[model samples]
Target: MLNLSESINKTLNNFAENTEMMWNFADDATDVLLGDLDTEIASTPYEIVYQQDRVKLKYYKSEAPVKMKTPLLVVYALINRETMLDLQPGRSVVKTFLDNGIDLYMIDWGYPTRKDRYMTIDDHVNGYMDDVVNYILKREKVPQVNLMGICMGGTFCVMYSALHADKVKNLVTTVAPTNFDTDQGLLHSWMKSVDVDRMMDTLGNMPGDLMNFGFLLLNPARLMIDKYQSFLENMNSRDFVENFVRMEKWIFDSPDVPGETFREFIKDFYQGNKLINSQMELGGKRVDLKNLTMPLLNIYGKFDHLVPPGACELLTSRVGSTDVQDVCIDTGHIGIYVSSKCQREFAPKICSWLGERDGNFSEPEVSSPVKKKTSKAKPAALQN
Candidate 1:
């Protein structure tokens, strides 16, 4: 409808504006990508209450008045640092629990070295975990404490709770793979073909980067391709860039898993699929899911590829606890713990669950799991 000259001028002006907009985006992106931004994680203030070998117990002293009788011990997986729980100020799981008047304690399984290659599930569960629980109980002067675990730590908690139900007032596990018979996860499929014996013998410890790459392979398009693309697309935003970098740091900060421990977990849990059936063993003792008779809360991510719902949901049906509950969060593995959307639900749910269970304990038994006698404990060998 316009004259030829007018139409041409209009088209040129539109093109010039588009070009300028892209240039502005590029400049802002450069600033975001290169500019200084704080990426520090686990910045919540805590005192190291107990230390033995590479492991240290972090007791988060809260300013808020305490309401619960039992102090909580947070056990994280050996694969990564527990810092994920306390990544930043507002997003910190530790802060959330503290703000809610829950006394909290966490285990920092520090980095592992070559000498840790021979450590096994027995050592972790019976040696370090038991000792840690003993330390917390002794320090807090409580007979039993609430124990919460994530991923591998959850598996350990299950094992511990099954063996020592009297020590744990309530049990909580998030995104923990229990029944590993399904084709719901890439790790399940790939681990079937893996030569864990050769890998452990040759490498001593499984590299964190290698394990991380395997996780990335689970969804190449989303994790490998699209995530970076999204970052690039939103690189101009300082907050976005800072959050992205923080996650990246956490993801890559994995520690080499101890060789024997890796071998046992891969063979026993991943390959043999023993935990659900009450067939796994640790430290000359048997690990029976039926032995987990404490008040149980099994939490899992619905979209968790690493540990599908099939892997987690079976725990409630299998465990011996009468007061068992399964909380299926509507998010992925990491997002269930740290996503802004999940932040309001996740910690509050856990705190409420624990608060309800705090005053409602079964009749007191003469023997308790958390009351193990420890005159002086030695250092555990491996790091996280």
Candidate 2:
């Protein structure tokens, strides 16, 4: 009887061990599969135009009715690909604006090569961006274009608006960092300690991988470990899996920032806080934020780690636009665009806001609703 009992115990232990092994194997397989899916979803369509030196413009197009009110120009930060706006058909901010009868153009600061190490903030804000705006204005035969900027791109737009306010009919900035002095965020604080010159000297051109890694490090526990574990728990559902993969691809699709530009950004804006202080200079011209008198819409993510609400809110008070309005969404940085909840709420709000200002009377028809496809999903507040 004792011998029989020992054999049965051994068999039960083996079964438990096999179950644990299988679970681990399944987890690994799920990870590999999700990684592959992310690559496929992020490869959305885009067109490239006017490549010169290391700068290129990439954009997405949609059909528009003739006599569209104002041409919309979107400027995205150089730290990542501009495709984040048009992430997918149903989930795209670009598509939403186009569907609303707005003519759209986006700036794609193509990945900087090693030789582009000398490109400065002036080159982007005052030189290349100015040329692009003029080109669009001349081609479209419009008196002015509506300007939108995202993150660092917002900084560029603000500078451009100060210099060429007459060229823009209205100005919009989303998740833009204007006042680096606000203590509500940690990113600017960290930037204060970085020796940008030494770093630029070492790297030549600031590598995208390095910038991406730093962002991930800011929320290492959540981005690195928790996010994947949650994905593992929901791998069986394909739709959830696809959306997850697409966002992953967007997050990782970083671009190299020019060294001189990065250096100036870190020193002038982050360290010196010169832009808001009215001491900032670009291309031998002072960047006077008070000169921004065009109708301004400043949108920011309330929980954004990169550009905190406090950092972004200073513009409403500083800019000369008496019509300035601030919209603080209950979101984090990327959530301003991606979160499924945002698609339903934030996008509609933006569409309405823009439509009202442009004299567009037609209501936006809701595209096919994208179901909450992800399983084991975290709340939008937590995910962002």
What is the C-alpha lDDT profile of model 2 across 1-384, one tens digit per residue? 458889899889988989987787687667766565533542435576556566666554556473247778899998887778767767777766666666678887877888888999999988899988888888779889889999999999999999899998889898989899877777788888888899999999888898888898888999899998888776765666777877877778887889999999999989899988778998899988889998898889888988999888888898888888788878899988877666665555555556677887554532344523322222342212
Top lDDT model: 1
Question: How many clashes show up per model?
Answer: 2, 0
Candidate 1: tens digits of C-alpha lDDT, residues 292-369: 889998888888888888888898999888998888877889998788656666776777778788863321111111
| Ten contiguous residues minimizing lDDT sum, candidate 1 | 375-384
TM-score of each: 0.89, 0.85
lDDT of each: 0.83, 0.78
Deviation (Å) of 169 in candidate 1: 0.5
Give the Å error, residue 30, model 1: 3.0
